[model samples]
Target chain A: MTAAAEFISVSKRFSRRAKVRTLAGLAGQWLRGPKRGPDGLLPHEFMALQDVSFAVQPGESLGIVGPNGSGKSTILKLLFRILRPDRGQVVTKGRVGGLIELGAGFHPYLSGRENVSINGAILGMSRADIRRQYEAIVEFSGLAEFMDMPVKDYSSGMYARLAFAIAAHANPDVLLVDEVLAVGDAGFQLKCYDWMARMRTSGRAVITVSHDMYAMAASTRCLFIKSGQVKAHGDARQVIEAYLTDLSRDRHDPVLETNFIKTADGVPRAEIKSVELLDGLGRPVTSIGHGANLMLRFHYHAAEQVHSPIFALTLFHDDPRYPLNLPRHYLFHVFSGPAFADQTLKGSGTVEVLVEDVRLPVGCYRAKTYLFERDGVSPIFVQDGVARLEVDRPDWSDGRPLLEHRQRWTITSHVST
Target chain B: MSPMSITAELREVAGARGLAWMLASREVRVRYKHTVLGIGWALALPVALMLVFTFLFTRVAKVDAGGLPYPVFVFLGLVPWQLHANILSGAARCLTDQRNLVTKVYFAREALPLSVVLSALVDFAVAMTVLAALMAWYGIAPGPGLALVPVVLAVQLALATGLALVLSAANLLYRDVQYVLQVGLQVWMFASSVVYPIPRTGNLKWLAWLNPMTPILDAWRTCITGAHFGLAPEFGLAALISVVVLVAGWRWFRRMERVFGELA
Candidate 1:
């Protein structure tokens, strides 16, 4: 048998102003343009889906993992036929059902039972067919008592339950889901994930787009999409590893390139461009071993006069919600003077703050920069979300501590019988 | 999903009469529930239209329904015409009316129109009952063709359903189609021989013959008029047209089914 779904070199190019062009272009093709037709007559074009091809066989659940705006949802839409492809074709060999958008086919005025029949039909069921499966659909939706009530009266969870019940009970050969588990409460999310797992076991080809790595790790077979293209198309574990590595690399740049933070205005606001955690001799440091010296390098450029500027660095965990502020002992004070040294200072300068035998917990952290005048006015410039650093502490085979650090973690492995 | 595989699923929608009855009852109950006169409105509508047309055509225009009282003739055609008009229009916009389920689940797409048609059938039956009472008051004895009314109505329904499927699918992609159909139905009601019968003319009769509704409505008039209306030929052609439209609509719907999820 042919594959459950096949995308053959399918590419969709969308004009930036396609909507405007479509409206205006139809009005008059009778007019000749001076040079081109008209500037706004045709919109700019860009490819949303590239010349990508993939096949999903029966009993395979493919997880699409990618960065935001990497055409993950577009793939699901193509499979669902929500939008026609501009190029190539998507051949589906089986009945296709989608939980693409929740509560899509419901009528506010219609009762759950009435909507179910209509919804079932839209999903390719007959009236008689929906009637036969009516009880099952109602039970699954958990709206047995409320079946007679109109859908407008349903709560969001009830709406999702009804929607999910309809899509799942459709029993289609191919299932296209996009972040369905992203809705409702945690319990409902888990329920949907469980249903997906059962669907995978039933030999139905399932294409799911999700950001939840744990769910992908548990249920999917082929992890195919990472940042729009197929990073690892076979093993789920390997693909996830590759995706995570890419994510880490993106967050932590190796070159330690200087990124200046400007004031609210677009002018060359701050004197110091950026400051990054670098190793000895000004090399970028990432995942430094516990017993190594770490240096915080400051790259500064003064567009105009700098008056008694003070550079301050604060360390905290990566999460801003509840940052674990570093102990003051971890701080290595560098050059302390009349801030910018002189009110006439106007050139580029590099300042390094070094900490020897740097030891912290094995985790990722962010370094914040603040610039202030010697008069103790509020810091003129504060830049955040700029830089990140990772600390790695090696461990032994028996789960015992291996790497030497000023502070040590004591633990004993209790063998449970 | 392949159309062949969905047949079993489609058949199950109509298998549960209770389910159909529940939906049908909801439509009926809701319409009359808040009304002071309840279902009297259903009877009053046709009676009122008949009286108005009877006065205007008989007294004002000096028109006649082949020597029969204008009220009775108009009433006969109006009963079936109203049902046909309501079902066709309602079912055309049924899918858009029920976008919630279409976007979410896998169900038979035909059920939306089917239920609306089913609900309107209840209204048709209620109107027919009032027609029976009016015929009795006028001492219009029953004829042999009276028994065939249900069969004639069934054919009318199939044609309406076929039209509904096409319009419903079209309405999903184009808003103007539904808007146009709403205006077209009123024009179509007058164009067909619903109120006044058109004398047999060269292409006029043929034009009426081409309209699937012409034969059904004409045959309905003949049934009550006790006239020899050779409706068999027209009915056959209309039935054929209904089937063609039905199949064409289904094919178009299936072809475009995949894109529905994306666009919708």
Candidate 2:
């Protein structure tokens, strides 16, 4: 029962801003010690992971799930030795193969034929091993005729296929992947999963990092991370359930909270001030009963007069009853944009979109809002999963609400000969 | 915890030596794949430089080549000098140029610069053929000193690899290293006496003694043309400096490799 890879209380951090790397900047930093703030770290440094520990046993697959920047990739990088931990140790038992950022190792100018040998070497495959697997790789990629062509000319699918083929043939005892499972078409993605499953069945460990909850849940075990801390770890099903529940617990009205310090891209024409989810009485609420009246308010600040702008909102649900291949998809997308209003706004103001009765699967859901200029296609500002909405089953019902819709319907029976 | 030994550090890098050659060959193949000249560019650089310096030094500067013909003497120095210069320039951008691979994949980070050196050695091999032709045309017979040529080249590789490791690691931190390298290479070339004979007995000899490349290029010239294979104190010093530079460079690079992914 030996583990293939283990992280012993590993922690790591990265600067929030690009490092000042010139001699002059380095000298200034040396003199000033980089201007530490209230925290021990310099003003710009943020912890990527904090004393997280885990192990992947041989034949066991571990999936890491998290929101963006939750340190899932850091764990993978630590195992692969791409990024060393600042404190604690990362130990791997054997040759580690990576599908991290798939096709990132391929030379664009080299032909697919040339890239196979090179990428195989990069994955720690011996020349003899690469030669032995060369035929299998080319066959699996199904690009035999196009092997001599430069990889740059291949479509993305071809590029990924060839890259995966070589990496699969690397034949390492441990596998590391970062969202590469989401690449290619659905059929090909299934192929990648099948490959990893085959590896695991043969007693090799597999560690994958992804935002895809379905993929995470399918693994033998899952780890949920939030803001550099491991929040939950155990059975894949329970860990994913904990993450979804954490997503639903937005108690402080994080939706309308404006301290999200993302650098504005250039000077935006208009800035999103806040987005609020309100009950019919004009009071903000994170959760609402099923079929209750709901209104979405988009607040904005305009530096100057702007022509009619489009405000769009979409509600997404990862409802399990649908059993979609992907765990999440948009349930509804509504646009109050383009010709919705021909008028211009000069300053700060708010716009509202009202849904009379919200009927959705009885679970937590996410909402994404976007603001675009007159043409209405280009986004000025976007906020995703910042707002959560819940549709509870009506108290009158003793059973579950309908999965598709909550509506009255009458059907006449028909007999077919 | 104890710091890692240099042997262990280098062994970790050796684990990926095959990758180094693979990347190097990929570079060579890609560079010459569609070119009509192919590897002619490698031959072109030193021969073209020898011709330019033959005119400039023999006619305008009126410098003596210590009784040897200007083309043979200068080409001897140019062959190894080009190897040195190519590796230096390659090392300056090695980490940054392969930024994607550096960040996304895990291997010994030194492989990037070492591969750059390997590609430059391709150029060195092509340029050596022209030197062989120059020696034959001059009717210079190979002497007993000719056997020391590999030893000279070995020392030269040590020096080039050491500097490459330093430059590649430094360039990853400060982009200014690349810009500095352009001007630095010109000054370094003139200071190393690639165009003139190595300074043996003058105040300039002190400056020549200080430059690590001077002894390397001097050894190349003497070893090829059957000159005295004297193991002078200066030569010993240069070889010692090369070993120290190589050991230090490997140590420094291994220490800095932890941040390569983040910086890249």
Candidate 3:
């Protein structure tokens, strides 16, 4: 069967600056004589998407995952015809609907009932179509009582619901949804997800471009793109796993590039110079399965005598959902017993932490090591990426768990006489 | 880019005309919403301009009215002039003003300019009612030439639609076009025979009739009095020019629209 929507080797480009050509600018170009680049693009033009291709079958939801400036939104805009592809053809079999912008054309002065008609029309529905769907749209939005009030009077959540209701009722054969679900209340977002699932079951194609890994895993298939090229495609969970692994790898680059404050008061305080994750045999490891012994080693140096210095180690998953809070959040933290104020050191040395049975569930985890004040509260030196850890899902495990808690349940039945 | 594709795109745009009409109606409704005088504001601009010109021409310039009431005479000119000016100014900024809609949504982009034309039509309809009231107050009766108003109106609409398309797309590209258009229209108004009596036959007639609006404004007044109104013979030229402008403007808009989102 043919795909509901397909990209056939599509390529799109943009100038270094947006192509705002005034008469004077055009005249200047004319006088200077134009030159073309290797890709047949004008000078200062760069290809945003370079011959990338993918498809979405009917009844399939495809999620696209990528970093910023990764040409993900460019694909949606090309498919929606807001931007035309410069090189290849983008084919869609039926009416295309975009959830790219919700409540975009709404006029503050217009009532909700009135904005329905205009917004519907702006979404490419006809007057007759809007009239037919008006009742259903208002009913689904759950704003039936507030339809006559000015849109400005509606809360932001109410506004999103109404906008979603109209676009959902547009009943498109292929929908291009671009991060619009990130807005609105959680309950409303779940409702929209339910609606999209229903549409998928009814044989509609949905292409979602979002950073939500969980949402991507829920799709039938996924495409992983980076730097204008396809890195991986097919099997939503696998694609998402690949994306996460690559993201953690990229996370290591910044740490190696970061310059740590190695000295305090022009004298070296005990500081962690390097870190390594080791196994039972003292071999360095990039990853290992759960339920195994793991060792963490920290290399340190000190130029002067330090009293009761404490070392802090912490572990956590790198969740893309909370980009700003990723590095600072810690799932578990531990400190040396030297905080009792008895231990003192004044030379280079190594410290080792070992766990007999690792309980971290299957996920990518980064470890951060810091040198704290004698009180073990204020950090004197910090390193973001001391070690990168991956906890693999064992063959016996049914599904990935947040924690590998060991538990058993016992039940006894007593007959009542 | 080909002729065939142009026809196809135009057919699609025709299908999206309903979107344009809805947006236009929404604009008209919003303009009147929560206002004290409401539609009175629509009538205010044309009437106020008519009063100003009446003062300028009758009291200051001491121009002859040649038997027609000065207020009635000037308003007849204001009706078409206002529609034309409103459309040009409105269309010139429609794309830039609604950059959010333009960049994110995909519809007939011509609809942006077309909606402005439609909203201006609403304002023009309101202004025409006041013109009728003014005509009644002056005791001027309808004549056989009243039938010719639709013809004059059609040519006027064609010109307005043509210019609307051009101004909107041009403004998106240059941005300077928006400011330039404001000053251009002001000069253009003085150049046309909007408030003065047209010379019958002379070098001054040549200068006055050379402006395309001269014939349109003349035809509007002569159509009221049931006169031949064909002396300038520029009506045929203006009609031809309107058609040329509309087709050319449409082509120009289509050529520039593919870049509107990225650049605008």
Query: TM-score of each model's B chain?
Result: 0.88, 0.95, 0.93
Candidate 1, A122-202: lDDT as tens digits? 566556667788888888777899988898898988988998888778788888888776667777777787888788788
Q: Rank the candidates by DockQ, best first.
A: 3, 2, 1
Model 3, runs deviating above 4 Å: A234-251, A256-265, A278-295, A315-328, A337-339, A352-366, A390-417, B1-7, B206-210, B225-233
Model 2: residues >4 Å from true position, as ranges?
A35-39, A251-417, B1-7, B228-231
Candidate 2 chain B weakest ten by summed lDDT:
B226-235
In model 1, how large is the Cα lDDT of residue B3? 35
- The sequence of per-residue lDDT tens digits that candidate 2 reaches over residues B149-208 is 788888889988999999998998999999999999999988886888656777787766
lDDT scores in order: 0.67, 0.79, 0.80
**Candidate 2 C-alpha lDDT tens digits along A7-53:** 88888978888763888888877897766677578778888999999
Cα error of candidate 1 at position A43, Å: 8.0
Best by DockQ: 3
User: Which candidate do you rate higher for lDDT, 1 or 2?
Assistant: 2
| Distance from true location, Cα of A216 in model 1, Å | 2.3
Ranking by lDDT: 3, 2, 1
Question: Among these predicted structures, which one has the highest TM-score?
Answer: 3
lDDT of 1 at A225: 58
- The model with the greater DockQ, 2 or 3, is 3
